[model samples]
Target: MEANYVSKTAKSMQLHRRAKQVLPAGVSYFIRYFKPYPFYVDWAKGSKIRDVDGNVYTDYWMGHYTHILGHSPSRIVKAVKEQIEHGTHYGVCHELEIALAEQVVKMVPSAEMVRFSNSGTEAAMYATRLARSYTGKNKIVKFEGGWHGGYDALHLAVKPPFELLESNGITDGALRDTIVAPFNNLQETKKRINDKEIAAVIVEPVIGAGGCIPAEKEFLKGLRELCHEKDAVLIFDEIITGFRLAPGGGQQYYGVIPDITILGKILGGGFPIGGVTGRRDIMERMDPLLYERPKFSFQGGTFTANPATLTAGLEMLRNLEDGRVINNLNRHGRRVYRGLEAVFERKKVDAVVNCVGSLFQVHFTREKVRDVNAAYRADKEKLAKYHSALMDNSVFFLPAKNGAISSAHSEEDLEKLILETERFVGESGY
Candidate 1:
């Protein structure tokens, strides 16, 4: 043990403390904490990540659900190398953009048009704009715990404490117009839509931040019906669920299509990227030239269509050929979820494992975690203990209990995780 506010790796510890002085909260995103400090990664390959001090672990965080293919994949690296030599960002049109967009449109059934951006955050940002701009509505409906990004409108009602649902966010026109309801509660969802001004209802088909909860088949169908009847757009925030579920995203996996879909994560092949894929007419409204001041929704990025990232993304999608990666991913993901469930049973742990595709969460509570409220029943203290134990054992999962598997996670890797997890259950008598 080094100091509480210091990273285990001394050089990075110094770097992080300095970062704290210059950067708010010591890092960019609130989620990247090692908290009481951090761990500084020097490199990662395949399923393993290594820190600056030679500590290594089989990682399942998978870069917050981005690297479905793997880290430093040979094809992506090679493509990036080629693209870099050709020059990184032309800030103008290029073939890689066409290639990436074509692949998305070809694969996603709902996508007739595509626009690139820099992150899942950006994808969510523009999706709402399109929904509002095309529909000419002022209000929005979002599931409680459904997070799109930092934009103030969608930011409301996200990750609210269970007790504070009505009280979450500032009591103002922006927050008031935005409705919040529990996840998987269709009736409550409808109640919110009663507001005629609601423009879109954005949801994650398989929630990333909310315990990887998948929408029930009936629930999603009902949502689609509600959207159609109300003339409101339904947007799927597939940033976490897009390529990870299947090439066509959660829509194809669940067989419920939305009016608009925001995509990111695995699409970028480990590079920073995002996209809005939707109906041509709705998306065309985003064309600046169509508006008087050319301002339907102002959005641009210096690295919007950078060749290196797109080339890597193009190659990354290539690895999904013949359904090799997804088939294996689901098989492995189910195994991990079930194995953990069995462990909880044997250890008499009052816990449940929730999963969708390659994502899973170990909720340390007996409650059926259907919504953000249900997930809140999980024992945070116990989860922290489990996270620490896993990390100490060279098994790197999300420090907050969320986990994902990649094409690189082997049976050997998974069972190793299970065995370590068993010890956690047995010792804690959870």
Candidate 2:
């Protein structure tokens, strides 16, 4: 498999060698790196990405699942092009920013106010600080498998061996107040959260980086009650599930509202952006006019609300506001989930498919993958091989990463995915 991939991606191999000389890990993000090097994309359109080697693959990765309407959708491209002519980055406020914020407030169930940032990590960091400021409590409760970016405060125990640090530089003081709780298991989570003065309970409605596992509706409801009982804020990290799940995001999809929503990915409309939004009272903690020093939770940057990002994001939201596009994606998600599961079962492959809305992942394990531990226990090596096989067959899914369905994906694209999986299963003797 490695040799076959290498033969097809000669140009990418050359670029990887060049990239390794400058960029750490030969990539901007470590997660983008894969065995035998990764392909360098020349361009992408609709649901296909063409590598520099001219190999066109049906893309399920979809720019880290950011392109809900598909790569360079005409609407966003047109809006961004016009906005770029005016100004790309304005180190000041603009109507586009206000428009985007208002759109967020109108769409998100709990968003009465919004603040933009550059990425999900920054949004998570800001949300943590704002939670601490609002409640005057230092402790935070996060699920065991929840991945809220690389923020130090909530970064621990994202994978298996849940007691270890996720990275090297994180200090004891940084994670001292962060508590790890079990996902999907409310009783265990409560035991973990017992008597702690939690400022916020942060969770991803559908776990992304940890696995494509979704929180049970009852579990989310339980967390909502728990947070309210403790007078702690309930934060939903809807970065992956934002507009992809519904116009109002996971909060609206699950019918359980949260105090804060951390958004990114599709919210940027394929541009670089992140956002924090919530009820007026909780969100106002970041307002300098409403709160004095020591109380204000600061959140600003040189590109906090860049005009270009806002323009693309605003246009994206306007298209999704009617719910037609989102509902179609959700329908596609269900079809893919059922189709993949049926294919695996027919092949007698002991695999589990985890899915929520437009996101899905295949675990090479017979056991149920309800949480991160189960996901980690799966045959990761086999899963990687399967993904590589799919890629070699011109269906791209980042190895061991969740696959996302976009509006651009057609019935044929989905059929090809299922067929490829079936082929991999039969050939691999799994």
Q: Which tens-of-lDDT digit does each residue in 1-430 have in candidate 2?
A: 8889899989999999999999999999999999879899989999999999999999999999999988999888988999999987879868988999999989999999999999999999999999999999999999888999999998889888988778999999998999888999999989988887899999999999988999999999999999999999999999999988889998999999999999999899899999999989988989899998979999999988999889999999999998999888889989998998999989899898998888999999999998999999999999999999999899999989999999999999999999999999999987
Model 2 accuracy (lDDT, Cα) = 0.92
Looking at model 1, report the run of 10 residues with the lowest lDDT sum: 1-10
Q: What tens digits encode model 1's per-residue C-alpha lDDT throughout 122-204?
A: 88888887788888886788887787877667776556563354334644665666777778989977875665667888889
True-vs-predicted CA distance for residue 390, candidate 1, Å: 0.4
Candidate 2 collision pairs: none
**Once superposed on the true structure, which residue ranges of model 2 sit more than 4 Å away at CA?**
none
- Candidates' TM-scores? 0.94, 0.99
Worst 10 residues of 2 by lDDT: 88-97
In candidate 2, residue 173 scores what lDDT?
97
**lDDT, residue 387, model 2:** 96
